[model samples]
Target: MLRRSAYKNLQQRASQLQLKRSASQSVASIYFPSEPTAPVLKTESIPGPKSVELNEELGKVFDNRAAYFVSDYKQSIGNYLSDADGNKLLDVYAQISSIALGYNNPELLKTAKSDEMASAIINRPALACFPSAEYGQVLKDGILAAAPKGMNKVWTALSGSCANETAYKAAFMYQAQKKRGSLDFTHEELSSVMENKAPGASDSAILSFEKGFHGRLFGSLSTTRSKAIHKLDIPAFPWPAAPFPKLKYPLDNHKHENHAEEDRCLGELEKIIKNHPTDIAALIVEPVQSEGGDNHATPYFFQGVRDICTKYEILMIVDEVQTGVGASGKFWAHEHWNLTTPPDMVTFSKKFQAAGFYFKNPDLQPAQPYRQFNTWCGDPSKALIARTIYQEIEKYDLVNKTQEVGDILYKSLDTLLSKYPTKMKNLRGENFGTFIAWDFTSVLERQEFLDTCRQYGVNIGGCGDSSVRLRPTLAFGEEHAKLFLGIVEEIFLKLYK
Candidate 1:
């Protein structure tokens, strides 16, 4: 057995590697301290008395049926979520994969407490019309600093749906400009558009893949095919949906079959672009389809899609909302694709705190202002937090660290997967940092498993169909990985025997 010194050495190394500030430095740590070295379970069931009471009170005024438990953000710490009942759980879901650098990070707290952040929060600006004094520099230092290669300009939005919806607008406007070719809009065109008619409204569509998700807004909901609940009641536009590949795993074990499957999907994608009922304005896809079961595609598959979109003059939009900001090993997951030409637009949110779309074509900007206008275009407060988050990520090289931890997690998970093959299968995200997931036999089984994880003091989450996804914070290091694996091993044993 490894000696106690082994663990000591690990912690010692962690201290040495942590930010190197003087002991007397007045700056407070941005994130909360790592605590509950192991998860602390107090009750037989989650949502124990305190949580149930809070939810019941909340239900009197709002929807609380979906409430998992009442969270106590103040008590939560790195990779652990604290509930009102005082249960601190190893949190892998990480607020539906949004939290980066973990809760209450020291650097983030400092940035939050800074004069700059306070000003931005109290006196927010309409970024597009009257950007603040620090707006230009703030963007250059933060979001743009980590932008996917070849993207320079960014248009901030409110959420993932807004980002995607705006990107679709940009694509439609850009495509119209390319077709219009210096011609002024006719009087009939302008008036007809107000009535939502053909000529001025442009009858163009954004092409999305099957089993994909963009958002819940009208334009974006049409592109979202992951679930019916998010779209069932909403009146949707008739946008074209292309088939995405369904590859067999382990990928290496079924190489040729997977390649053939990708090719088949590519064929369908090309056909959809060429023969869609409406002109295809853009083709949007997730680098790793997060809401659609952590589905992944190969570089070859993406390149093929890019080629098809180019050939058909359809703009390519990579929806990196959940796959951006270093969660997927690289800063942007599409960075792993190595396309010969960059995507037309990249929509982002989740980990960045700030939400927006990056573009190279200035034509994507509407010919007139207020066409893509909103009250608060995007929050500068979130942008300030994003800047701090980006800087801290660089300071600690947290992306690379997450990637290293992911490798360890993957290997251990493979052993667990083997032990309970019937309970789980198609394990993925091997080299893609800590953005990992696996499939259960059924949706019920998967839901039960998540509940079981909660009983064991691990707040895990499920995704598209029957997948148990791992979307831990970037600060989920080797120690967290080991603890997670220990619980998982125990759960699998209990599940099987």
Candidate 2:
């Protein structure tokens, strides 16, 4: 009888222990775990032997000159990137600012393995011609759900360049349609377009800023003025490049001068619009000029552009390909501007995975079909991924978290950079989430700093000549920020000493 009583008591304790274990494993706990305690440097040098060998082999068939190292993505977890050489890096670049969540996110993996995902991937739908029945529901639940304020529609495309190009097409067509009110295309117009001439082929131009980088395609490349290499040898459109405001840093100190500078640029922009020979259909600008060295302008400056565009009846296209999807403390970076009138169109890609333009006006869609048609209009698989990303972001409240973490990172860098003014200057993107950057005195210094950072197991990236830009994932937290800061400070000290 005593043995039976003891057995019953043991069974009750085991059941209690099982219940405790189940309670501890909540859904949230399964998703975001603590990041690596510190970076692990397994290789003496980055792009170690294995990486070099793979790149050497890859170069035989493809251009691998720009590859930092071939990544072992399967081994990469969270904010860490694993290279072919088995080096795990604290990745701040986040696949050139494309990764919304950290690597191998559990939620994303679950989505990836779903039956819906399998269908989308294997039977990729040509969205415009023969869209799948489920396409609308997918977009509605995913992409459209995360639309910027006032944006009601999106036209999906393949990449950032393609998204911008499509927006340009929409702009050109809209202007043409407006001009040809209640009119049909003439035989001359039809024939001339076939020959790639004016009247049928657009003589209208898209205006971009001096340091703006749009894309590498023919039309988009014309608007991309960041680097000569991106534009060289390609015949460009007769587009005008306006001056972007070059504001002084520590903005409070030089408020008057910066304000005057913005005025000067705004004045020049209007002058260019009035004087340009071709009709200025639209003007494209970045909230933060990313590739053009992380150049930034004030909300006042962006607002001025909006006012000018409004006055001229020109469309304003905010290119948020690099800055969108919660990176800049907002779903869309342009939201920070709080424009009196919403932009005519906004182009996006990178972090969103699905590339496209968002607009409120139905007029942006062409009057007839085939005008904006393409094969496999967009990958539905990517849309599925985008959907998962957006849902996870909303569920986790990552945008606000990014803002909180970004503030800590910016302040930490501000303190660190103060000690090495010459080595790092123009620390920008304060309060702009994890999208921060600082200018090095020279290209060599910048490269050296990046190389040294990598040696210390942090994979950062550079932009627009001599600037180090941080593009950490939305998952990058206070712990990750502290780790990054400590590594950077160590590098800076070693370099200076």
lDDT of each: 0.85, 0.87
Per-residue CA lDDT of candidate 2, range 28-85, in tens? 2335454344455566678788999999999999988999998999888888899987
How well does candidate 2 match the true structure in TM-score terms?
0.94
RMSD of each: 4.9, 9.2
Would you estimate the TM-scores of all the predictions? Answer: 0.93, 0.94
Please report the TM-score between candidate 1 and the true structure: 0.93
Off by over 4 Å in 2: 1-35
Q: Please identify model 1 stretches exceeding 4 Å from their true place.
A: 1-34
Clash list (residue pairs), candidate 2: none
- Pick out the ten consecutive residues of candidate 2 with the lowest summed lDDT: 19-28
